[model samples]
Target: MTRLVAVSGSLRRESANTTLLRAAIALAPSDIAVTLYEGVGDLPQFNPDIEHDAPPLVQAWRALLRDCDGIVVACPEYVHGVPGAFKNALDWVVGSTELAGKRVALINASGRAVHCHAALVEIITTMGWIVVDQASPVIPVAGKNYTQADMIGNPALAQPLLAALHAMAGVPAMAD
Candidate 1:
């Protein structure tokens, strides 16, 4: 099975980006298992002084990234850029080797995310990770509050989602 760990950029209890990751997990193919990782919000702010002996949470976070086959990020734009909390989470791994050569897919669950996505792509690429281009979509699901069951019931949600998964898996895109 292809094990994927998904991260949502929002810290809100009712974040659409979190819902979108759940939906993606539900819509994935049988061979792929997507697990949503909620540690981004729980991570301590990056501290370069303590890089060698990192905090327990940072250690756990890196361990998770190392164990996963791929990573998927569902994010919302904050003032035309990535959220500071999410950015901090990324910073925690800036010097780690966990993400090197791993496959990653970006899902922008906001209407205006061009700049944010571009910046993210650059960051992920700089980490030596391969960003699955076709799977990266600015889906604009900010306020939709969709759940797994809702996506399973709606082809509009399921199809493109499956397509994104397929892209990440290096398979041809699925039809809607």
Candidate 2:
């Protein structure tokens, strides 16, 4: 089984990015398991001095990334850049090898969030993760208030997401 961890860059209670990941979990094929990582908000600030003695949450976060075959990130742009909290979570593992050689799929919840998307691609690549271009898709769910059900039920949204999942899983995309 291919295990994938999905992360939402936003901490909002009703984040469209989170909703998109939830929809991804629902739409994933039986062979691919997409687990949503919800502990980003709980991680402490990045401290290079204390990285070796990392706290429990940081340890857990790194372990999750290490164990997963790949990661799916759905993020919303904040002030023309990646959100602070999400960037902080990444900083925790920046100096570690936990994510080295891992595959990554970036899901853009808003097409307007190009800045964050580019920044994320650069960050993920610099961290030694392979960014799957085929899996990175712009779904444009921003300001739509879209629910998981709405995304799963709509072919326009669902098809692209499924194709992304397939790409991450190394499964050939089925002919429509």
Candidate 3:
């Protein structure tokens, strides 16, 4: 099975990014398992002093990334940059070898979040991750109170997400 971890950069309870990921989970094929990583909000701030001896949460985060075949990130832009909490989560793994050569698919829930998306691409690329262009799509779900079912039901949102999952799985997208 091609396992992919989906992460939402927003920590908000009603985050559209998180909802988009949930839709991805629902739309993923059986062969491609999409697991949502919910520990970003719980992760402690990054500190270089404790790099070698990281806390349990950081360790667990690394382990998950190490085990997964790829990662799907949906992030929101804050003041035209990546969110602090999400950036902190990425910082914790910057020194580790877990993300080297890993495939990452960036899902943009808002079309206006270009800045954060670009920043994320730079950050992940610097960490040795291979960003899959086909998998990275701007779905534009911002400001809309979209439920998981709403996203899953709409082909406009679902088709691209399904294609993204297939791209991450290194497989050709099947005809619907």
In terms of lDDT, the best-performing candidate is: 3
- Score every model by TM-score: 0.92, 0.98, 0.98
lDDT of each: 0.83, 0.93, 0.94
| 105: Cα error in model 1, Å | 0.5
Candidate 1 lDDT score at position 159:
71
Q: Write the per-residue lDDT of candidate 1 for residues 1-176, one digit (tens) a residue.
A: 88899999889998888888888887788988898999888888899999879999999998899999888998777888889999998888888875689889898776577888888998889988888888877676677777667756877666777788887777797554
Clashes of each: 0, 0, 0
Off by over 4 Å in 2: none
The better-scoring model by lDDT among 1 and 2 is 2
The better-scoring model by TM-score among 1 and 2 is 2
lDDT string, candidate 3, 1-176, tens digits: 99999999999999999999999998887899999999999999999999889999999999999999999999999999999999999999998885699999999999998899999999999999999999999998888999999999999999999999999998989897
Model 2, poorest ten-residue lDDT window?
91-100
Candidate 3 TM-score versus the reference: 0.98
Instruction: lDDT winner between 1 and 3, please give it.
Output: 3
Which residue pairs collide in model 2, if any?
Answer: none
- Show the lowest summed lDDT stretch of 10 residues, model 3: 93-102
Cα misplacement distance, residue 21 of candidate 2 (Å): 0.2
Ranking by lDDT: 3, 2, 1
